[model samples]
Structures are given as C-alpha cells and as structure tokens.
Target: MKLGIFLLAAQFEAGDQGTVLTSAMDAGCAAEEAGFDEAWIAEHHFVPYGLCPSAVTFAAMLLGRTDRLRVGTAISVLPNTHPVALGEQAALLDQLSGGRFTLGIGRGGPWVDLEVFGSGIERYDEEGWAESVDLLMRWLTLRRVGAEGKHFRFRPVPVVPRPLTRPHPPAIIACTSATSAALAARQGLPMLLGMHADDCEKAEMISAYDAAARACGRDPRGVEHAAASVALVADSRAEAVRELKAALPRWLNRGLSAHQTVDGRARTMRDPHAYTDYLCEIHPVGTPRDVIAALRRTTEATGIRRHLLFAEGAGRPERTLDNIHRLGKEVLPEIRADAEQ
Candidate 1:
C-alpha cells in the first residue's frame, strides 16, 4: 500500500495566503524527507477554503522542490477549465516531472467559480462531468482529439508533447456519489474517495464500483483506488482529538462560509463542530498505534491500496508538520510491514 499527504493549504489563522502556501510546500518536502510516497494537493477558487487555486501549477512547483516525492492534484476542478487545455498542462507536468504527476479530476460544486471561469452552472451536473472526462481521456490517450459534447465542441487537434506515461499520467476521479463512482468505473479510472466517508461507506462504494466496472467489461482488480482520511498523531487518542476539535472547526466553518452559489440557490452547509467530531470518529486521529490500526482496517474493508492522509486537520503549520513526521516515521513502517504480511 502507498501513503501520501493531502495538502489542503487552508488558511486557518489571521495571516497572508503566502504563509499557508509556503507551509504546504514545506509539508510536501517534509513528506519526501520522511519517506512518504506522494503529496496530493487540493484546489479551490475564489475561496480561502483552499488557497491554491491551481493544483496543477502548485504540483509543478512542488515537483521541482522535491526529488522523490510524487505530486498530484486531489482534484483539478474540471468544470472551471477546458479539458484539452487542462490536459496539455497535465501532460507537460507529467513529462517534465519524469512522470511523477497524477491528475485527479472532479466535478466541483455550483460555486461562483463556474460563473467566474465562464463554465456556467450547467457543468456542475453528471452529464457535464462525463463529457469533460471523455474529452480529457481522449486527449491523454490518443494522438489527436476532437470534442462534440454538449459542454464543449472542438475540431480535431494534435495532442502536443504527448504524455510520458502511456495513455496519460495516472489519473483518478473524485467519487463523492454513486453516480461519480459509476462514472469512474465505466471509464476504468480509479476512484479518489473523499475523507468524510467511513470504512463501511467506502466498502459499499468500492463494491458498487466493482459491479459497475464488471458491467463495463473492465476488471476491477487492476484498478488501484485511493481513499483520503484526516490524520493526526499524539501520545494518546484524546489529545489528538482534542487538538483537532479545537482548531479544525474554526477553519472548517470559516472556509465553508466563504463559498457562494453561482445561481443564488440555497446550499446547506455542514455544522463545522459536528463535522469535526464525525471526522475524528471516522479517521485516524489518534496515537501511532491507533492510526496504523485504523488505516489497516480501512484498507482491509475497502480494498483501497493508496491513502492520502490529510494531516492538516490540526489547522496549524507546526502541528501539521509534527503529525506528518509521526505518520511517516512511526506509523508508515508498521503499515508497510502489515501490508507485506
């Protein structure tokens, strides 16, 4: 099994965006030094929820900064940019980075990002996501491509630079719902399961994905799916939970409130405090032993081989770094040993 850090670059304290971004980059470098596999970055637009607006761009910067650590986007919001344009950048990064880049695409919310990026709210639905993925796959896999989908229409054009990883750099789809999981399965792409879902829920989603893949004449066993989980390390579970509960709620509430619906539609936001509690309950917010056990149980239940650990739950740079170090030094060796067994 592979383990990586999920870099949210979220601003929790009263400070400039630069500090959050720098801390995030430092975390990525620290992951490499600590012997983790990769670092996945989260993208957000016009919101302080995540300061990195372009995951691909941020990934390129981090790739240059680290020698062995693979860099990827937790998701590059598909609705906000043209698939071909995004593909070109992904290909370029993959080629330049020696194929160490992973592209995780997703259908982001109906936020004001759509209006600002000129994609409109129509692209927030299933059909739009499907079309974008189709075009993206074609661009990545084929020498030339054209799009006649409802969301995009284009004449055939050559795929420039081409991808270093045949068919494209490893790509995954962020699956938040059954429809999204099925969509990924049909395409034979791996699913990037979010942090909010529990082991049981992830197991169910994986089962559904397998069924969908079988229906599409794809072998599910070959797909290496990834799951994200909030992680923190302390001497005891209570201390970890206490640290996360105090700061994560404030960060969550602040960031959640920053989102604005593009169409003025009412959006229900999760209660930050309650959501934090649920995350602690479901994820690896505990001591080294507890974290390793939870991660092992999750992998066993869901058949997920890769994990993106969101250690930023501590909501402070120092605490987050400490968590990552403990995860890499104390927890990782045990997890790898268990996997070998």
Candidate 2:
C-alpha cells in the first residue's frame, strides 16, 4: 500500500500562526525522511481551520524542500479561482518539480467558504464545479482552447509551459458525496475520500465509484482511490487513547463547527468521550499494532490501497513528530507487507 501524509496546517491556538506553518513544513520534511510517498496540503480562507490559503504556493515551497516526495493540493477550491490561471500554476509547478505535482481540485464547502471568498452559495453547486473542471482539463490538455460555457467564456488561447507529465499531471477529485464520486468515475479521475467517513460510508462510496466507472466503460481497477483519516501511533493503545482524548476533540469540534451550521449557529460536539469513541471506531488512532489492525479492517472493507494520514491536529509539534516517526518505523512496513501477501 502507498502511504502519504495530509498537512492540514491547522492553527489550533491564537498567536501560533508562525509555529503552525513552521511545524507543517518541518512535518513535510520529516514525512519525506520517514519514507512517505506524497504530502498533500489543504486550502482554507479567513479561518484557522486551515492556515494555508493557497495550496499551490505551499506545494511549491514543499517541492523546493523535498527531493523525492511528491507535493499536491489536497484540493484547490475551484469556484474561487480561475481555471486557466490554476492550470498555468499547476503546469509550471509540475515542470519545476520534474513531474512531482498532482492537481487535486474540488468544489470547496460548508457554505461559509463561498461567502468568505465572495463566491455566492449559488455557485457552489455541481453544475458550477463541473464547468470549472471541464475548463481546467481543457486548459491542461489542449494547446489552444476556447470556452463558451455559461460560467466561463474566452477566445482560443494557447497555454504556455505545458506540464511535465505529458497531457498534464495527474488530477484527483476530492470526493465527499456519492454524486462527486460518480462524477469522478465518469471522468476517469481518481478520488481522495475524506477522513470523517466511517467504514460503511467509505465502502458504499467506493462501491458506487467503481460501479460508475464500470458503467462508463472505464476499468474500475485502474482507479487509484485514497482514504484519509487522523492517525497517531504510540507505544500502547492506552497511551494513544490518552493523547487522543486530549487532542482529537479539539480538532473534531473545530472541524465540525467550521464546516456545518444549524439555524445559523455553528454545529459542535460537546462530549469529548463520545467524539473520541466515534474517532476510535472510524480512524487509525492508536498504537502501531492497533493502527495496523484498524487499517487492515478498513482495507478489507473498502479495497483501497492508498492511505493518507492526517498526523497534525491539536497535538504539539513534538508529539506529532513522534507519531510520524512511529508510523514510519512500525506501521507502514507492516501494511506494505500485508498488501504483498
């Protein structure tokens, strides 16, 4: 199985922006040294939910720092940016990195991002996202193209400095819903499944994606889907649970509140134990052995081979570093070995 890390670069506390970004970059370096395949960064605006607002810029910084590790945007929010401009930036980064860049694009969410970015909620629908993706693919693949779509219109123009990876670098869709999964499959694109989904949800989503791909006359086996979850590896399950009990709730509450609303109030989970129980049931958060078992169960359930670990959250940098080290030294090899068998 291929292993990667997702750098949320979350700012959990006030007056800690610099520390958060520095720790994130350091984590990227550590992930490379620890034998991770890729480092995916998140993009968010006007919030500490994710400190990095421009995943392409952050990806450039990481690509400059790492020799072997591929750097990608977990997603660059599509509706807020111009597709042609994004295509140019991605192509340039792919060239600069010698084909080490992947463009993961998505319709960003929770309704608040659209309002914050001045892209009204009306534009956050599937039609808008599909139009953006269509324009983006055309920009990346064609030498000269013109679009006459409702959302975008332009004269035929050539894109300079085409990407290093021939037609363009690989593009993966961030799939959070069944509609998005089917869209990805219809386009023959891979998907990055979010960490918040349970095993049953993931299985259903993957099954839907595979069926959609096959229905589209595309081979489902050719699709490379990744499942993401918050992970921490420690000496024992007790140690892991203790640390997670302190940290995961903060992360979950921040995430949930940031992404959802009820009657104009932010949604939140107040009970840490209940939230932690849900997390332990869904994520790979425990000792190496426990993580291995959890991941094995997930793979068995979903048939996914790529696992992306969100190792940084409300935890301290030292603890996050330790978790990465243990994941590299203990969990990854076992997962790979099991995959071989």
Candidate 3:
C-alpha cells in the first residue's frame, strides 16, 4: 500500500504568488518527512485552477528538499506540448530527482485548455489521445521514429540525455474512459484514474485496466493501477468535513471542469450549479476513521495498489502535515504491504 501526497501549486488568492508557492513547497517537504512514497504535482494554465504551468520545474524545487520521495506531474498534458521537447524536460527532471521521477502524461481535456493549444474538440476522443501518446512513446525511445497515421510525424534527432531511468521512467496515464484504460493496458503504462466517485468506481477501474492489459497480451504485472481520492483526514469526522468544505472546492471544481475542446466541442465547469452535486458524492472528506473506512472499502472494491491523497491548506499546514504523518504511521501499515495481494 504505497501512499502519495498530491500537490497543485495554483494561485488561489489574487496576490502573493510567491507566498502560495512557498506554502506548496512546505507541503511537499512535509509529505517527504511523513514517509510517503511520492508527491505528485499537477499541471494547469491561465486559470486560478492551477498556476503550475510547468510541473517538471516544480519537481526540481522539491528534489532539493526531499530525500526519497519521487516527484512527478500527476499528468502532463502531452498534446499541448511537443513530445520531443517535453521528453527532454522529463529527462532533466528524472536526473534532478536522482532517478526518482515518474512520467505521467495525459491529453488535455478542459475545452479551454485544448482551445488554448489550438487542438479542436475532436482531438479529445480516444483515437486522438492514443495517437499523441503513441508518437510520444516512439519519440522518447527512438528519436527518429516516423508515423503516417491520423496525428504526428517528426524529423528525428536522437534525443540526448535520454532519461536516467530505464525506458524513460515509469509511464502513467490520467485515465478518464475505457478507451484510455485500454491504451494504458496495451502500452503497459499504469492508469491514474481521475474523476471517479468512490471505492466501487476505483475497484471497477482497476479491474478495467488489468483486463484491458491482459486482453492486449500485456503482462498484468506490468500494468499498475492507482487512484487519487481527495481525502481530508483529521482527528474526527467533523473536523475533516469542516476542512474539506473549505478546501475541496479548489480540487474538485478544478478537476471536473477540466475537459478538452477538440472536435468543435468546447466545455466548461462554467456550470457552477453542478459543483456541489458532483463533489459530495465523489470526494472523501471526513475524519481519519471515515477516510480509512472509505479507502479500505474502495480498495476492497477496486484492488488498487497505490493511493494518492490530494490535500493541503494555507492557514493550516499543520493539520495537513498531521494528516499525512498519521497516514504514514497508521493508514499504510494496516494495509497489506504487497501491492499484488
């Protein structure tokens, strides 16, 4: 049961960007000290949703502070950036983390995000994402790889530095659909299940990932499945709820609102009416006991190996830090250490 702490460095308040970033840094340091396996930073743009336009840059900042924690972008939207350039950036980050970088990539979905990148709504479809990822994989491994399909072809120069970790670090996908899961399975990359509601959904997604992998003649052992359920752990369920009410709008609203605008499709979380209805059902936002019970239930249902907890607070870093310490000291030990089990 490997636990991860998820961080997103977004400008929540209008002022003090540096101060907010420092708080995020402090949170990462706290996560490392709390004995978690990783701290995943997310990527976003031109919005208060997430100020972290460059997640690898954020990784470099954490590498200097934490000893063992692997620094990763929860998922870098590959379609928006040239894979070749991002591959080089990831290589540098892999070295910076002392080979502790995990490469998590996804196709940007928030309609606005895709629009910004000049990719249309049709690009959000599975085929588009698959094409983008396939090209990315080829470019990262074989510099001159050429393709004549629906998407990409690049004149190749062998990308230098070539990543410090074998096969260019473990690859992960931020999963949204069965098609995406199938791609992850076929490619033997782990699925980072996003936008799920609870334990039942997670278990179902894990099964889906493994099934897709096995069906593709890929080893199930090579297909890692994990999910980040927004948890605000505290001493009591009441306090957890209070904290969640205050903090959760930042994560859920930001996440659910993010989908791609390809194929003439532009979407927005612009519908504020849906926020409350969506989060209440999906997010785990209570005490330690409530979180543990919810997580155990979800794990039992989903069979996920890794759990990433996305949580942080400005005025109460202590509470966030305390939650992680308790998670490391208590939550992980109770779960069977072997992921395969």
Candidate 4:
C-alpha cells in the first residue's frame, strides 16, 4: 500500500507562526527521510484550525526542500480561488517537483473561509462547485479554453506552463458525500475519503464511487482511492491510544467550533463525550501490529490502496515525528510485505 502523511499545520499552543510553519516543513522532511511516499497539506483561512491559506505556495516550499517525496494539497478549496490561477500554479509546481505533485480539489464546507475569501456560499453549492471543477480540469488539460457558466466566464485564453505529468498532475477529488463521490467518478478522478467516516460508510461510499465510475464508462478497478485516518504507531497499543485520545478532542472540538449555523448553533461541538466516542470509533491508533490489522481490514473492505496518515494534527510536533518514524521503521514494511504476499 502507498503511505503518506497529511499535515494540517494547525496551531494548538501560543507560539510564533514561524515556529508552526517551520515545524510543518520539518515534518515533511522527516516523512521523506522516514520513507513516506507523499506529504499532503491542508488549506484554511482566518483560523488556527489550519494555518495554510495557500496550499500551492506551501507545496512549492516543500517541493524545493525534498528530493523525492511527492507533495500535494489535502485540498485546495475550489470556490475560494480562480481555476485558471490554480491550474497555472499546479502546473508550475508539478514541473518544479519533477512530476511529483498531486492536485486535490474540493468544495469546502460552509465555513469562515468563504466569508473571509469573499466567495459567497452560493459558489459552494452543488451546481457552482461542479462548474468550478469543470473549469479547473479544462484549464489544466486544454491549451486554450473558454467557458460560459453561472460561476465563471472566460473568452478563449491560453494556459501556460502545462503540467509535466502528461495530461496533468493527478487531480483527485476530496469526497465527503455520496454526491462528491459521484462527481469524482464521473470525472474519472480518484478520491480522498476523510477519517470522519466509519468502516461501513467508507465501504458504501467506495462501492458507490465504483458503480458510478463504471456507469461513466470508466474502469472502477483501475481507479485509486485514498483513505485518511489518524494513525499513531507506538511501542505499545496503550501508549498510542492514550496519546491519540489526549490530542483528538482538541482537533475535533476546534473543527466543530469553526463551522456553525447563522443562528449561532454549534451542533457537533456541544458534546465532548460524543466527539471522543466518535474519534475512537474512526481513527486507527495503536501499536504497529494493531494499526496494521486495522488498515488491512479497511483495505479489504474499501479497496483503498493509498493510506493518508494524519499523524500531525492537534499541533503535537514531537508526537507527529515519532509517529512518522515508527510508521516507517515498524509499520510500513509489514504493510508492504503483507500486500506483496
């Protein structure tokens, strides 16, 4: 199985922004040294939930720092930026990284990002988001493209710095819902499924994605799907779970607090106990042996080949490096061996 680290660059303590950013880059270097294949970074705005506002810029920095580790956006919020600009940036990054860039796009949630970026919530709706994705693909693939849509209008214009990766850097969709899964399938793109989904939900979603892809005249088996989950492989299962349990609440609560209704209702953030229960139910946190078992079960159920390990969340830099080390030294080889067998 392909293994990668997901860096959220979240700030949990009162520290200099430079320190947090440095730690994130350091984590990417560590992941590379530890034999990880890729490192994906998240984009957020006006919140400490995620410090990276421009994933493309951050990806450039990491690409320059690492020699072989592929760098990508966990997601570049589509509605928040222009498709043309994004395509140009991604193409340049792919060239600079020697074809080691993956462009993951998503219709972000109804959050402060939209308000802060002045991208109205309407653009985040189904129709608008679909339009954005279409335009993005056009910009990436076509030499000269024009589009007339409710969300975007452009006369025929040339897109320079075409991506080095044949058609374009692998463009994957971040699938959070069934609709998103269908969108990815229809576009013949892979998906990045989040950790919030349980095993049953993940399996169901993957099945739906496969069916949709087949309906679109694409081969489902050939498409690569990735699953993101918090993974911490420690010497003992008890230690791993304890560390994860201690850090997870902050990440969950912060996410919940960031997205809320106009009427000031924080639905998911209200219940800490339920959040903890849900976290334990979804994440794969334990010793190397236990994590491998859990991952194998997930792969069997969902046919996920790429496992995006989110071991850097909740702002624990030390723990993040340790998890990456243990994953490389103790877990990854076993997982690869099992796959080979």
Candidate 5:
C-alpha cells in the first residue's frame, strides 16, 4: 500500500495563520522524511477548516521543499477557477517536479467562494463542472487545445511546459456521490474518497464507479484509487482518542460553521463532536496495530491501495509530526507486509 499525508492547513488556534501554514509546510517535509509516497494539499476559501486558498500554489511550494515526495492538491476546487489556467499550473509543477505532481479537482460546494472569485453560482452546477473537468483534461493531454463550452470559450493554445508525465501528470477526482464517481469513471480517472464516508459507503461508491466505467467501455482494474482517513497514534486507543477529542471538534465547529452559501441555500452543518466520534470509529487511530487493522479493513472493503492519512487531529504541530513519524515507522511496514500477503 502507498501511504501519503493529507495537508489541510487547518487553523486550530485563533490568530495563528502563519504558524498553522508553517506547520503544514513542516508536516509536508516531515511526511517526506518519514518516507511517505505523497502529500496532498487541501483548498479552502474564507474558512479556517482549510486555510490554503490555492492548492496548486501550496503544492508547488511543498514540491520544491521536498525532492523525493510527490505533491498534489487533495482538490483544487474546479468551480472557482479557470480550468486552462489551473491546467497550465499543474503542467508547470509536474515538469519542474520531475512528474511528481498529481492534480485532483472537485466540484466544490455552493459556498460564497463562487461569489468572491466571480465564478457565479451558475458555475457550481453539474453542467459547468463537467465542462470544466473536460476542458482541463484536454489542456493536460493535448499539445494545442481550445474550449467552446457553456462555461468557457477559448481559442486553441499551446500547452507549454507539457507535463513530464505522458498524457499528463496523474489526475484524480475528489468525489463523494455516485454522480461524481460516474464522472470520474467516464474520464478514466480514479476517485479520491474523503474521510467523511465510512468503508461501506466508500465501497458502494467504488461499485458505482466500476459500473459506470464498464458502461462507458473503460476498464477500471488498473486505477489507483485513494481514500483519506484520519490518523492519530498514541500509546493507547484511549489516549489517542482523548487527544483528538479535545481539539479536532473545536476546529471542526469553527471551520464548518464559517461556510456561507452564495444563494443562501441551506447547508446542513454536522455536529462537530458527533462527527469526530464517527471519524474515530471509521478511521485509523490509536496504536500502530489499531491503525493497521483499520486501514486493512478499509482497503479490503474499498479495494483501495493508496491512503492519504490526515494526521493533524490533535490540532498541534508537534503531535501531528509525531503521528507522521509513527505512521511511517510502525504502520507502513505492516501495511506493506499485509499487502504482500
């Protein structure tokens, strides 16, 4: 199994943007040092849930900071940005990083981010999202490309610095629903499952994706699917849970509540404490053995081999770094051993 870190850049403490950002960077460096395969950056706007507004930009920085580690956007919100421009950035990063970049895009929520970025609420719709992803794919793959879609109208342009990865650097779609899974399958790309869903739900989505791929005459057997899960390692399960319960809920409560819809659409926010409990139940936490078992169960259920572990559940950089180290030292070896079997 390939292991990676999910860098959310979540600001857990008030007025600590710089510290949080630095910690995120440190986490990426630590991930590489800890022998991780990749570090995926999260994109969020006007919220502390994730402070990085431009995942690609942040990814570029992380890529430069580490030589062997592959860097990617857990998702660069497609609705709020121009696909061609984003594609160009991805290609540039891929080339510079020696093909160590992965571009993961998603149809972000109907949040005020659309208004702030002047993308309009219409861009958040199904049609707009599909068009953008298609355009992006073309940009990454074709030498010269143009788009004449409902949301974009552009003349053919050269794809400069053409990605070092043939066809394009690896592209993943962050998907939660069956519709999005189908889209990813149709595009012949893999899905980046989130931590919010349990293993069974993830398995269902994978099934949906496989069905869609088969219907579209595409084989899904070789796709390297990835899933994000929370990780916090301690001497015991109770200690790990205690550490996460004390801080993660507060961060979730503040960050989730900060989201505002552009059209005043009702967005049901989860109860942070309850959600944390749910994550603890589904995700890998506690001792290395416990984490390995959790991850093994998830892998078996979802047929996933790549894992993006979110190790900042304690909302402290030191603790987060410790988790990364332990993950690489204790958990990764066992996971690889199990995979070999």
Candidate 6:
C-alpha cells in the first residue's frame, strides 16, 4: 500500500497564497526527505477559495523544487477544459518532472467557478464528462487524436513535446460519484477517490470502482484504489483538533472558494455546511495514533490499496507544512514498515 499527500493551495484571502505556496514547497521537500511516494495538488480559481487554478503548472514548479516525490494534480477538472490543451500541459509537466506526473481528472462540481469562469456549465453533465475524459485520454496518450465527438473535435492534431514517460503518463480518475467511478473503471485508469464525507461512501465508491473495473475485463487489483481524506495529525489529539477547528469554517463553506476538501489534511469542505454530519465519520483527525487507527478502520471496511492524507486548508502555511512533517516523520514510517512486514 502507498501513502500519499494532497497539498491544497487555497487561493482565498490576502497575503495567504504566497505563504501557502511556500509552505507547500517546503512540505514537498520534507515529504521527499521523509520518503513518501506521491505529492498531489488540487486546483481552484478566484479569491479565498483557491489560488491554484493551474495544477499542472504548479505541479511542474513543485517538481522543480522537490526530488523523489512524484507530483500529481490530485485532480484537474478535465471536463471543463479543452482536452488537447490539458494534454499538452500534462505532457510538459511529465517531461519537466522526469516522468513523475500522474494526471487526476475530475468532472467538477463547484458552480461558482464554472459560472464565473464561463466554463460551459451546461455541459457539466455525466455524458459531457464521459466524452471529454475519453477524448482527453486519447489525446494525452496517443499524442494524435482524431476523435470527433458531439462536444469536441480535432483533425489529427499532434501535440508537441510528448511525455517523457513511455506510452504516456500514468493517470488517475478522481472518482467522486458512481457515474465517475464507472467511467474510471471502464477505462482501466487508477482510482483516486477524494473528499468522501464518511467511510461508507469511500467503501461504496471503491466497491463501485472495483466492480466496474472487474466488469470491464480488467483485474481490479491491478488498478490503484487510493483513499483521499482530510487529515490533521499532531503530537497530541487536542492540538490536532485545534488546527482543524481553526480552518473548519472556510474549509467547509461553498462560497469561500472552489475547492472540494478541508481539514488541511484529507478532504475538502465542498458544502457550505462544513464537516457537518458527513465529515465527523470520515476525516482522519487527532494524534498520529488516532489517525492510524482511523486508517486501519477504513482499510478494514473498504479494502483500500493506498492512503492519501490532505494537509491544506484555510490556515497558516507553516502550520499546514508542520502537520505534514509530523505525519511523515512520526506516523507513516511505522505504517510503511508494517506494510512491508
């Protein structure tokens, strides 16, 4: 099993974005030092929500700054962007990172971002996502796409500066709903399930993903099924709770920004209601021991193959990076050793 981290670059408020970026870069270096497999980042536009509207560019920047840690766009909203452009950006990042990029595509849900950015919210449906993703994959891996779908079209255009990795860069679908899960499974792409309010949904999503994958003539075990959740681990449970509590309001509200997870650890506060009834059951909070226990429980329930802890939210950059350091240093080593054993 692999342990991952999703670093959120919350674009909200004044004097926070630069600090957050610094903190994230620092944390990336630390995670590499601590020996984690992948470091993911999410995207958002506008103020107080997320400053990182460009995950691929930021991913490349982080790649330049870090060594060893694989950089990922924990998710890039593929349905909203032109597939060819997205592919070009991803391939460039893969080359820049020495083939360390894994693109995580999402259907997108935040209305504010779409409405404001004119991302064609009318096409924000299941069919739209499915078709767009299909085309995006074809373009990303095949280099030359000739797909002429109802929504998108291309005339054998070849994207330049192809990925440094062979064939193409490995990809993950940020599975949220069952429909999305089915899409990912059928495509044989890896699963990067994010922001589940509870364990049951995580289990349900993973099961749906696996069932679909198996049904699609592929071995479910061969595809990655990683669990992404909001986390806040500390030396003490009280301190961990305090850090999350401080970020809870912004992390939970919808109007704050276009994000999906909160807690500065695992998931986003997609709804304006904050963690509410859904978060209490799923987010991994408290001391390192508590987080480990929650993880064990989640694995027992869902058969998760990878665990990704999110450590970004409406908080000080230093504090967020500190949280990552604590998890990497005091927590993950034992789990990795245990898994090896």
lDDT of 5 at 102: 94
Instruction: Report clash pairs, candidate 1.
Output: none
Off by over 4 Å in 5: none
Candidate maximizing lDDT: 5
Runs of candidate 1 with Cα error greater than 4 angstroms are none
Query: Is candidate 1 or 5 superior in lDDT?
Result: 5
lDDT per residue as tens, model 6, 60-172 = 88788887888888778775577778988888888777888889888667445565556565456777778888887776777666877878765887768778877778888
lDDT of 6: 0.73
Model 1: per-residue lDDT, tens digit, 257-335? 9999999999988999999999999898799989988888888888887999997887889888888899999999988
Please write out the lDDT profile of model 5 over residues 109-164, one tens digit for every residue: 99999999999888888888898899999889989998788889978888886888
* TM-score: model 5 vs. ground truth: 0.98
lDDT string for model 3 (249-320, tens) is 654565445543434444545343355335434655565556667667666677675777877632255666
Better of 1 and 2 by lDDT: 1
- How do all models score by TM-score? 0.98, 0.93, 0.85, 0.94, 0.98, 0.87
Model 4, range 144-174, lDDT digits (tens) per residue? 8898999888789887888888776788999
Residue ranges of candidate 4 with Cα displaced over 4 Å: 260-270, 313-315
- Whichever of 3 and 4 has more TM-score, that candidate is 4
lDDT of 5 at 198: 94
In model 2, what lDDT does residue 112 have? 65
Of 4 and 5, which scores higher on TM-score? 5
Q: What lDDT does the true structure give each of the candidates?
A: 0.90, 0.83, 0.69, 0.82, 0.92, 0.73
